[model samples]
Target chain A: MEAIIPVIITSVCVYGLFRRINIFDSFVEGVKEGFGTVRFVAPTMIALLVAVGTLRASGFLDFIAELISPLAESVGFPAELVPMGLLRPVSGSGATALLTGIYRDCGPDSFAGRCASVVAGSTETTFYAVTMYYGAAGIKKIRHTLFSALLADLTAIIVSVITVGLLMS
Target chain B: MSYIFGVMIALGFIYALVSGNMAALSAGIPEAAASAVELLISISGMLCMWSGFMRIAKDCGLTEKLARLLAPLLRRLYPDIDPDSKAFGYISVNISANLLGLGNAATPPGLNAMRELRKRSGTEIASDSMITFVVMNTASIQLVPATVAALRKSYGSTQPFDIIICVWITSAVALAVGLMSSRLISALTRRGRIWKR
Candidate 1:
């Protein structure tokens, strides 16, 4: 299944040549456009990247993590995982680090670690995708992208909680 | 986002001063920028490769085939987009690749699809289709969270895909709800209804 993308690309190339399309020319055209887009979005991406890094490093994420465990302490999830759920959408690497850290600290079979695993898998970097796509697409008015993405992330979090409750218990 | 960046930096600075991790905070700024650059460099390759394939696919009417397949669902979602446009092809690729948990490959096609949607939009403001496309891409319901599978494997899980049902259900719910919210908001906010042809 992982090979599907490569297979798709190769077949497209072969099909392009079979159709007598200048595959090289079209490839170059696409590359040029991609380069232009990268240049255009670099600043916005940088802004997001830097913000994500600082948000993680500044202990703010830790603070949020601390705040979450008490709210639902009855379920008995570890406080260590709250950061993983919150940060997954803001930053992937941060969440991965958090996931591994939680696994190491709490043991992968622990309820907290299981919750982290499910939560991490269930969500995407909603804001990051939103930022990159909007920047690349050059749509100034972002409209409901952020709201919708966050709502999805929230849903992912809620569903993760439920899944863990069902499977881990 | 700029405001968020500023706030983050300011918070970082204040936290560093209060916590005496100023050196670490200062050091992390440049490192973050560098990593962001590295990310773009790698993503640029993915973007170029998939965009080129999309071009090839478009030339061969493969996208039209995809469009035909997804039209019933997407047509109502993207009323502004022409039925025959190549955007549908890329959109289909984006949707499928994401569902299969091909995150990296899903992106270039996603970017391609968004670019096409943006072209159709033609205004600074996002159109309904563009907004919906972004929402779908953002919450591209994966059947398998491949990254999570790898993580589970490394942690010595007997079965890595145990989370598959969970991810599938969660993402499906997220996608459905997100698209509706985005569409509803877009409609509510549509005052001028400008589509530059």
Candidate 2:
């Protein structure tokens, strides 16, 4: 696992050399453009992070989780994992923090721990990805993207619990 | 996007107002701004490295070869982009990096792919292909879920990889749902002729 990236890098350079591609110049050019890409992505990311942070700090996430608890429970989903499921699609770091907390509170071998791991492992930060990709491309009207992404995120969370229950337990 | 962001902030601020958590909310704003910089600082290095290597790969025809190999399948999803084009090549590399659980490494190719798609479409509104691409990414398509496994291992789980099968199941389902919903909504929007953009 550790050797994979280095091997790929070396192979790309070697391949470039064999093809007479001037890998150094190519690399430098890409890096220069990457600097601009970072600059382009920063403002949206900062604004997004603050929005998510505000939501979390205001305890709205907990409120939403509580509101959804009965529905989650009726589906056999553990209430403890609701906050995690809610946060998974919005904030990657927040989901990770919740996942870690689950591991600590329930131990990784427990049902909630297993479910949390599956949830964390299977759900991407839909909001962040949509924002970054669309924002970078200067696309303002995202249309059905957020709708579709949230649907997928919901699927991941629901299926995580089901699959974990079936396989891990 | 504005509506979502605005709703998030507005609802949060309103909740804080009603619940009297304004101090914590105010503190989180700057903290999140700072963390955004921290996140960028961590990702930029890897982003540069991967983008550089990707450029080398592209120059040497590696990405083109990979794109050709993946084209039959990718073509079905992204019919707008020509199989042999740079956009397709970047899309192929992005998906491959994502499958390998190289999330940071995937971003450069993903962004390049988006840019290429945007250029090809020449539209400010996202095309079906771009929507499809972003949905695929947001579905957690990684095969191994390496970070999750590593976290489990660090927490003393003996069989960290045990959840690999479950991850696979959930990812495939999520991706399927995402793609299908996007396609469905796209068809509906087109039929209704509600494409204001």
Q: Pick the TM-score winner.
A: 2
Q: Which consecutive 10 residues in model 1 chain A have the weakest lDDT in total?
A: A1-10
Give a tens-digit lDDT track for model 2, residues B1-197. Answer: 68867988999999999999999999977886786677656557655666677667767877556656776889999887887798888899888767655566689999999999899888899999999999988888765565566567666777766777888898889889989999998898797886665
Please provide, for model 1 over A1-169, each residue's C-alpha lDDT reduced to its tens digit, 9 standing for 90 to 100. Answer: 3454457678878988888888888878766765776687677666666765675566655566668768767665567766667767876665665675565456666667667777787677788888899899888888777898889877777777677678647
Clashing pairs in 2: none
lDDT of 1: 0.69
Error of 2 at A25 (Å): 21
Q: Could you tally the backbone clashes for each prediction?
A: 0, 0
User: How many angstroms is residue A72 displaced in model 2 relative to the true structure, after the best TM-score fit?
Assistant: 3.4
C-alpha lDDT of all candidate models, in order? 0.69, 0.79
- Top candidate by DockQ: 2
lDDT of 2 at B139: 81
- The alpha-carbon deviation from the true structure for residue A94 of candidate 1, after best TM-score superposition, in angstroms, is 0.9
- Model 1 Cα lDDT, one tens digit per residue, B1-197: 45645876788778767777777767777877786776556556655655565655655656456546766787777777776778876877777656544455578988898888877767888777777888887774665454555555566666655666666677777778888888777666564365431
